[model samples]
Target: MVSSDHIGPNETGRIRATVKTDGKKGRILKTVQVETNDPVRPLVVLKLRANVIDAFHEKPLQPDAIFRSPCRKCHLDRGRDQMGAALFRADCIMCHMRGKSAPSISSLKKLSRERLKEAIEEGVPDSMMPGFSWRVGGPLTEAQIRSLLKYIKGR
Candidate 1:
């Protein structure tokens, strides 16, 4: 998206762009090309770079904040009545997918079933990974946790 299609002589224009940081992290780079009438520089390329932080990157002062308000919309609601890959896509992928702060799906596949189950139920110590089991104040139920475990291990 651009601010304007044309710029008058001796005038300046703006180029605007938006990147969806959801399910992504680390350094991100993108490029945009603009065509101009200037003979000396008919085309200009703009480089956009950003460092995405995890949605839960904030201090542990409010670990359960994700289960409330605006965060709940994406973190909780999306996983309602969902199971297996669908559930992971809705709830887990945002942070656990590639390039994000948490472990990627491929990496998770390497863990034993018991380890994965414990992580999901009890969360990891001193890490951003939060417990998704109801006993730990998370939104997932026993059945859901089982489903997630099965899905993750199968992958």
Candidate 2:
């Protein structure tokens, strides 16, 4: 459904779409044709891709649930006090707990700046810590990763 059929000059448009697979699996691709009255371009195509998995569904994670993991509860309040702190709290704090399977961020003090940067950018092998650098399909930028490193080292 489209919010408005007609779009005015310099105005934005909103569209709400729903696709039902109905128990089908595998990759599904669909293209939506948006008809417009502009002289230069009359139609726009929007491609949407969805992957349907048959098993092992995953739950979405919420940033506000900062204390979902037991270890996060320990530094619950203190963890929210830095630039990268929010980033870390949103992405890392869950798996990288102090006494859990993943080593705590506090232990990163032993690593050199270059090594730490590589670990975040390239990720650890055979480990749960995924790379956060966009170069490797991760979400974090160099500056944001550096900020996280600085936050980890208490600097």
Clashes of each: 0, 0
* Cα RMSD, each candidate: 5.0, 15.3
Off by over 4 Å in 2: 1-83
- How would you encode candidate 1's per-residue C-alpha lDDT over 22-104 as one tens digit per residue? 64668998888888788999999889899988765555645566788867887789999889889999989887879787899
- Runs off by more than 4 Å, candidate 1: 1-61
C-alpha positional error of residue 53 in candidate 2 after TM-score superposition, expressed in Å: 20
TM-score of 1: 0.63
In candidate 1, how many clashes are counted?
Answer: 0
